[model samples]
Target: MDAESQRVLEYLTEVEEGAEDVLATKQQIVDLDTKRNQNREALNALKTEMSDSGHPELRGYNLSPLSTEEIKAMNSILKR
Candidate 1:
């Protein structure tokens, strides 16, 4: 085969690989989003349960109606 033809084939192969990589990354992003939603649902359920449990200690600590964002902020502060 001529050098130019080989170069074209190599370029096309690279393009295909790049497309495959993009597809894989997109799938990974979708999977992560699904996992995040599931985690959020579970966390929300736990918060409701904590509130319904009527635990005096939880009320005292004000953790029964916990907000996910608040927890994230607390973690950020602690990290600092």
Candidate 2:
């Protein structure tokens, strides 16, 4: 093959490498956005829990839940 053909092959290789890099960066951005949205949802849930003073009691047997002290500490953190 001619030198011109070799140069065209090299240029195509370079472009392919760049396209791969762009795809990887785009994937990272998508992952980060998903994480951010999930965190936002969690924060909203926390806010709702904090604002709602009355938590319904759970009945029906031997369910060992958080101690009253632990519950208080969690509530305090939510307050801040």
**Which structure among the candidates has the greatest TM-score?**
1
Residue range 1-80, candidate 2, lDDT tens digits: 99999999999999999999999999999999999999999999999987785544643466789999999999999999
Task: Report the alpha-carbon TM-score of model 2 versus the true structure.
Answer: 0.64
lDDT, model 2, position 58:
48
- Over 4 Å off, model 2: 54-80
Q: Against the unseen true structure, what C-alpha lDDT does each candidate score?
A: 0.93, 0.93
Lowest-sum lDDT 10-residue window in model 1: 57-66
- Per-prediction backbone clash count: 0, 0
Write one digit per residue (lDDT tens) for candidate 1, span 7-44: 99999999999999999999999999999999999999
Q: What's the distance in Å from true for residue 21, model 1?
A: 0.8
